[model samples]
Target: MEETWNEVLRDLSVPEDIATKWWSQIMVQYTESARIYHTMDNYLRKKFEIYDIMVKDNISERSAFVLAMFFQHYEHDTNVYGDSIDKNVEHVKNFFKDAGINHEGLISTVVGLLGAACESGSSKEGIDAYFQDLELAALGASPDEYVEYITDIEKEYSNMPAHFYRSLRLKVLQTLLLIPKIYSTDLFYEKYETQARENIEKEINEVLK
Candidate 1:
């Protein structure tokens, strides 16, 4: 992933020194002991896989999208979800400033994408829909893979009482199930929609039991 990060930074015309410094910080942040499901090797990698597909289809504002993905979770904290979003937004702004990136349009697009992520809501059109769908692509994983995802997430919340955790998890599943479409984009909707619904229903049943 270091190699990939470096390549992306180079493609974006970031200086070698700045890229190296950013990579070092990313390594430390992502590998922290508190992170489980949210690790670079897991959640972020999955999202990037979807991003790659979008790239193949020639998505606009590619650089902005990639940068948004990186900075969205650059400062994540499981203990305080709300605060994490604000911190990540601030960190992203500071990163662009420190990197001496002066493209106001690119910066605005990246920041807007990050803000959309913080809302955790779906968009009806535009790249924002694709971005939101990418974040939730995991829901369409095969049964076994989905189970693994649930297990990893459970590990992340192990400090909470099992019953309380189940309650929260059930509510979340129910809320998602109520959405008109779990994935916002046509690509994601066609590919993962059915499986995602099935997965959510099965998990909801398990939580109820």
Candidate 2:
């Protein structure tokens, strides 16, 4: 990992200090001390919390902050583990910001998902509409099945061996690459898919190599 990052750092050909900062940032994510389960569990908890938060009509600032946590939440809730959640959360936060994807509408649509869960929203039915709104690839076409796929995977993430976390992350990257189109909606496809793919490819290469 360090070697790859060093290669990237040198490729950028920046000043020593700038390269050092970038390397430090990359290494911070690479050296996260927590088992992936803790990070995954926090992500799940935040997702559930956001769902419950959306059930209410009035969303307070704190509530919105809670929602924001889905985008940037770190869980260091255990004394047993050293520092599991913060670095992982930091990596995600950086990813979202770097993705440059406008999430405003996507955020609003997700909050509406819990409500839509009943109508045609039973995971399968609802997710197609949801994904169309978010414009992720063909993932939403079969909503419930996709939901189950994700849920099952999250479950696996929580239980998988610590050494395999990188492998699991790679698997997910490969899955996305295999999708017919990364963004189902033409808007996202046109605007963000290329950069998104490049970012994923970089990470995928980092993990595999």
Candidate 3:
């Protein structure tokens, strides 16, 4: 997957160090602790989404937009709002500002950022909130939830037997797929969901094999 990510970067002529910085920061932010929620291929695909959207919108040259997001200060990760939601919001705003996207409404309803706020009013809010806030809301998520996950992982990691580890990993991936769709916006789901599901299913099949 790193190779795929690197190849995308290279094809775009992204600097090697920029990729390295993004990689290190991503690992530290998402996988270092309790693994709030993560998937490298997904994130890389997001970069793909960003590039594809920019191309469609004509906001900026796709490669340039990719470079800015690749080195964006606030990460695009699985953090809930309270953890870095505001920062994530700010980051997207800054990206648009820098890229000359000029779409004011985007900041207000950024998918995976303030967009999760919508889940609060939906019938599925109970379940959606856990993942949305944890993975999407950025700084909007509660500190308590983050802390609890860390505490739980700490207690469990040392004694997590090999089989349990495999089961948990499979469970997480399966749970993500079980969701109606991984993306929120109609545009993204319509354009990317099918491919995303295929990628995820392929991964699961490989693991089971």
Candidate 4:
């Protein structure tokens, strides 16, 4: 069988760098290492809630809202939220009431970020403007354009193992995808450059055949 995106994601496991970044940005501010497991537990539970609802309702939205949620949360410490984290947590906890299956941790983080972003008020409008620009950039291109672009890159880099090349490429692509919404300023360039180097050293180096 062909690989689904979720399968690709699961095979890679969570990146240690991502975990460390997350801990540093959000968790460490409020809790200790002992709480990380519990926090992960909460994230997974929120993810499952979205998954079950999505599966039950079978809404076939092509937009991949859950994945979008995950990206927003992972990259931004904030999501759509109001008042205290406690108050916002409940709203996020229930957003998946009828949505279908998705990657658990990914969805939860995104949901949380969505809450935080909304809480900030500026995020929604800003992201909306950014995506408008993104849509214009896409023009009337076919969806396969992306698949073909990645495939071409893979072919050109065939000397290396596909997994290694793709992993690094994926990180770069994710960064580009979120640059406007997540970075918004050049101040994060150093951080992203460091992350790129780290990805090359860790993921690409090991996975290369």
TM-score of 3: 0.33
Measured by lDDT, the strongest candidate is 1
Tens digits of per-residue lDDT for model 2, 158-186: 54564576676688779878866665444
What shift in Å separates residue 109 of candidate 3 from its native position after superposition?
9.0
Model 2 residue 162 CA deviation in Å: 4.9
Tens digit per residue, CA lDDT, model 3, 1-209: 35544664576455777666555665464444433233343333444444454233533333333333333324533323344545656655554464345544433334343434334433332222332322332211244443443344334343466566557656766976887766554444555566556655655675587
- Residue-level error in angstroms, candidate 2, position 53: 22
User: What is the C-alpha local distance difference test score of each model?
Assistant: 0.81, 0.42, 0.45, 0.37
Using TM-score as the measure, name the better of candidate 1 and candidate 2: 1
RMSD of 4: 19.0
The segments of candidate 2 whose C-alpha lies over 4 angstroms from its true place after superposition are 1-162
lDDT head-to-head 2 vs 3, winner: 3
Clashes of each: 0, 4, 12, 19
Residue pairs with backbone atoms closer than 3 Å in model 2 (clashes): 123-144, 124-143, 124-144, 136-184
lDDT of candidate model 1 versus the reference: 0.81
Q: Which candidate has the top score in TM-score?
A: 1
On residues 43-152, what C-alpha lDDT tens digit does candidate 1 reach at each position?
87877777777543656777787778887788767667778788888887887887888889988888888888735565565777888888788989999999999999
lDDT of 4: 0.37
